[model samples]
Target: MADDPSDQDGALSRRRLLASSAAAGGAVWLLRGLVRPGSAHAAPGAPPGLPAGLDVYQRAYENWAGEIRTDELWTCAPRTPQEVLDVVNWAYGAGWTVRAQGRRHGWAPLTVADGTPAATRVILLDTTAYLTAMTVDGQAADGSATVRVQTGASLESLLAFAGAGGYGVTAAPAPGDLSVGGALAVGAHGTAVPAVGETPSPGHGYGSLSNLVTELTAVVWDGGAGRYVLRTVGRAEPDCDALLTHLGRSLVTEAVLRVGADVNLRCRSYLDVPAAELFAAPGAPAGTRTLAGFVDGTGRAEAIWFAFTDKPWLKTWAVTPDRPLAARAVSGPYNYPFSDSLPEPVARLAGDLVSGAWASAPLFGQVQYLLAKVALTGDITDVLLSGTLVQDVLTGDVLTHLLLDGLRSDLWGASRNLLEYVRPTTLRETANGYAVLVRRADLQWVVSRFADFYRTLLAQYAARSEYPVNGQVEIRVTGLEDPSVCGVPGARPPLLSALRPRPDRPDVDTAVWIDILSLPATPALPRFYRDVEQFLLGLDGERATVRVEWSKGWAYTDTAAWSDQDVLTGAIPDSHRAGGGPGWDEAVAVLGRLDPHHVLSSPFLDALLS
Candidate 1:
């Protein structure tokens, strides 16, 4: 919305000085190409063929769960497109691989790893340092809005930019810290759909943020130029589909996303619904508060069922033009105060568990459940208004509160604000995530079966004196990013996006995302995750297709995430094939052609792309 080239120049100059100072002062790593103005190289041990005057330094990186960490390596923060292009070309020529580093709020090892030779001769392309420019690129003929953004820009910045420009995404991941480049690369998403009595917005699709991309500009090999150059790919091009969700096989510098008019959203939470009733069998009594029942009532719903507990925290968001009766109006995000900041009691329990009180894991789990219960009930006034209405509007058991209490669940804000509900610093835990795509009719059945399986597995683990999980099982539902909704000529859904709809199952438009969170220290998490992974993957293909969420943990084995040999070699490849379609092959081929030298790669990516 505003232009300031001078400000950009100043910022770049300051970063250059920092890089130069670090290099001159015996910096551990150097930006191979970015030498100080008076120096030939940034550091004495500078690698060959690096361009001078680049912003490079030594930096350590960590993934969200702290499961993925990379030793301090030579990292570059390119502020402009030319800078990125130069870095890629230099890396290609020097035989060094480059990986884009966003917020690293992920569990996968697509970018960097903890150990092994793969971490050698690798450099992190830190996008967040300088490439965060965003501009509204005018409206299309169909009245759809378009905004061009630097890939390194965080979702929070993008949302702020969009809100300022009078445009916004239909849904976004709860954590605002995710970088635009990372989210698009991994198909990050949020829970959203057309409400029961609402009409779908124009130029909006209920899919991952990757679906919002109308065009993306990336640094790719250019034979004509004999160097990597910035190339803008339109959504209609087949290569665009592959780039939409590149899985770190390629690098994107910027993207043009199609967005719609901003809207107000009201999100409410309820925790009295017993897991048994909510996840009951599909044919259970009509009055039961089933997961599907919540979805049918309002398209947006999330259920967080804590381990070793009966009640689940149910959050439902609906598009509301104005505040509903007895609902507390929220001004900003992170409305779940207790969740945003751990309560003292819970923190103490967590500390003790971390301090070698391994056997206290079960007790820790109970404490967490009790904390949530106390926080939810004690602070009802903080998130809701008039406890009498909560009591009077419901009928039958405590579960009835779900029906009437959802509207009064204490937070009302704009879609963007409400979507940014996750705190930047919160519980750090390893999580296994999956997206189960099924038709609306099968939502109840799928949820029930999965919940039953999870419950039984936890019981079995407990029987063996193994408290594998101490956190909650979070479940959310969202519509797939239907390409047709974008209304772009020749637009096709991202080939690799989990939200991509299947051609054979036209009726299967919704995706149910489930997450099981627990600390990495959990004694039996890997085995527990393995069983869950198998159950999800073994679901009836005709009824539901399970796919790993790109940024979240998956491919569970007894020892690690993304290390299940069968999943990596079989299930993953097959799931992307989408019932023997050529899309997967086509996407891989296009990506290969774009980066013939594989300049943009890591060991994990190399294995997957190979």
Candidate 2:
């Protein structure tokens, strides 16, 4: 589906008209406002006993989706690991808490709580400023290698460095801008599982990134020394399991991660599959183009279902040593230009919805679906044939420009290029996340049940003139953590990772990650999310388990997220406690022992972990 030059002139005129209309709606203004960086300034007085020469300032804190914001707080950029230790010691003795700030690309309040005042006795340690040093350590005899990287390093830089050394992880989170420290702390993950008849490569893992760590250095209290000090722990150590995914209760400065030889991947996007068939029940007739079928073929896939849309945009990635004839070769990541940068039409529609045009929710959903269809397949027929609302928003000029800008339906490149596609410029939406651990055979059942419930709930809301969701529903599948992949004897799965295997149910090896996203302030979203959470908490009965994704929103109430006391204190911990062998309680105990003074803890962590 290539572009036709015969329609260029007319498309250009139409695009100009649409662009002017979008500008009038303040689309460009909103885009600029979202991307503009916040400024920091020198504080009038530094904290008492702060280490000399440490760069300290007051800066505002804002999370990825702008759902969490704090006033100007004391922040410091330590130049070395020793400086970090010094700050920790000072905070411990001065009755203050220390929180590491890296990229601020997370949704949860693991780092700092919303509305934190400047006078609060907490300091934000900026890791990205000076601690981002990475080096390729030696390689082992089995072609597996390890890299020593500072926690402050961004995932993009770490992947680039590893890829340059002919080593790379099997999967990583979509956004490369996230700091390595934050990603590991939250047990961030990407989608992949063993394809049928496929064996995993040496040092490769399909679970959370925390499973790849072999050694880590963290700041911990020392009873003998009478203050906080640096402690290095190997994966074989029992405490290391808890440190692997500490949820901001501990601070890790550096880590040694196992990496396998780099592999090329071919990622293909499909927009023709209807949601009903894709998420069909498990017993559907054989040879259907179901989600499970795609997983069996490629092992790595993600489904993005726009709200109120039947056909979803599905992306599948396969290990490809040689470029496929139909795939476009790429050298870098963030290949989805249409999604990475908000189109004028999309921005305009989003602005309208934000400005109280709640009745346009259906149009907005259709526009998003058509945008993906045209951008991925280069087929503008649907947009051209759509009703006036879609056509007027997505004019011919915009469609032509997208086609001529080199977006492709299928792309082949290095592993990093295909794995990391979400750029920082993309529209930021608040999301609620969970990982449903079930037997591989039951993956289809889980997906189908969730899809049916979500569809019904969305319709019920629409019937009440309520439009709570303005973003897509994302679904991915991955394998549970296998400690043997770390290449360390006696290594244990991260105690707090959502992918941690259940001893009582060895058959539950696959985790189906489900997330629903929406604009930050959408009305009735909290209620919708609460209903979904309650349903998922009871899904699959005793045959499956659902655990919250730490980096995203969870613990829901009718009014807001992360506010349900029953979920925060009971259900979340119990999810990890069930079928357990050294799970939630063990992780909390170890984290508490490491930071006896609670120097690295936040109020939210204290409540949730307790």
Candidate 3:
């Protein structure tokens, strides 16, 4: 099913496009699912890198955040999947648990250990030194324009490679620092305004850039089945399809995907659209999105409504044809952190790295990551650059609406802040779908622009509405590209089938992400998560179910309720749903077929295989 390729088949006509409830790009994605990655892991014995050995003191100290780190980590720079499997197999015998890590840039225990026994034996199989090869072939094994990427490849390398070959990825995560594997693991994405005939959609399992991957090769451990490199019969296994959202208890090694002819991209972003005008705009493009800002040459487009602050709304965008992507400033990251608060040492490093050509990594550990964030296009790290303030928004709907009102009227007038969670939609499948939670934080910002409006809205809304719903509002959207669907011969659309790289999750089934998640133990958020559960369940249709992003701490019961079989079956098979399927028995059986000695099964696999 090659999708429609024009702006006309667009879900709407000009005037009526505003306020259109039709979630534009949603229909096409109805056929697939997307969650998307970062943070790299190192393996043992290859190159004794810094922070070597799990010396008790070192382990705790390395992860300064505490909750997100565990003693189960190794510090070697593994450059091959065999190295990954060797570590996994060794850990199985040594009774140590294992995990794959990238960048290690997350703020939470997303990759940290839980109370699981596996936590005791955890090891970090680092991929930083892995083979970073990306190749473009004239034809696929079956004959197509294919791009082959090793798990360690970078998004920038792939883009630059495609450009030289006269091709381009349909879409990619906003920033370019993330490793190819890391980015996909977290469901990273950029806000892509659908083409005229296209529809606007959410970012879920796979987005525009994801369609590129058509094949995946990985190492799987079924305990009883042992360790075997499983080759999924593409059109035969239903598990294969649902499993793409997760790497399926396996370590992804490499992938092959398709790319499209290179073409220039035109992007234009600006702000300032009245509220009444925003809602009053034509419904979203027929079935997609509505232009919400400018009335003439500047079409009413998209807007971001932040939580807290008097200024409730900020950010707007519209694209013009033939304008192409702006040439990146020759050197800007070195300019500054936009604030004096950055530690002097860090500040100095950030500026120097940016001012230079930036070809190599920084001498200091976290310094390179810090600077890379500023130098790259906005993605997870956009906050640091935008000077975004993080806060805890108590739970309440009225508070939610009030905070939004303040954002537009008082706090931030034109700037926006974003949140990124690399967890599953619901807790049951915490390893599946990653959601990039976006919202504006900090009423303190009202000190600058919308101060009075900010104070007034928060007070008014708090009094009227039940309260606020999580000082943050995770207004959700999705982008789905059916891994099962692909383009036919001779068809060249903006989104090619080669983009769907599989997703990877290398954390404990659940990890405490950061300090904010360490809420006092009490009501346990049953009510709040319930409302969220009900709404997501409500969104479930006969063929699909809505999933949440980084929902582990939202309460086990609430997550269980939101992920019930009747609710999840539409989106995922009941067999694969959780404690179901051929259950662990089938998994073990397959693992046996793949690995007879159970060489790869660790305690993590035993929980399912035993």
Clashes of each: 5, 0, 120
Question: Candidate 1 residues 122-237, lDDT tens each?
Answer: 87789998999989886866557888899999999999888876677778899988999999999999987666676777767688888888899987888887888888999987
Which scores better on TM-score, 1 or 2? Answer: 2
Structure candidate 1, residue pairs in collision: 33-50, 33-51, 34-54, 35-53, 383-410
Local distance difference test, each candidate: 0.75, 0.87, 0.33
In model 1, which runs have C-alpha deviations exceeding 4 angstroms? 1-44, 116-119, 140-143, 379-408
Q: What tens-digit string does per-residue lDDT give for candidate 2 at 218-320?
A: 9988899899989999999869999999999999999999999999999999999999999999888877899999999999999999988999999999999
Q: What TM-score does model 1 achieve against the real structure? A: 0.87
Per-model TM values vs. the true structure: 0.87, 0.94, 0.51
Q: How do these models rank on lDDT, best leading?
A: 2, 1, 3
Better of 2 and 3 by TM-score: 2
Model 2 TM-score is 0.94
Question: Once model 3 is optimally superposed onto the true structure by TM-score, how far is the C-alpha of residue 168 displaced, in angstroms?
Answer: 2.5
State which candidate has the highest lDDT: 2
Candidates in descending TM-score order:
2, 1, 3
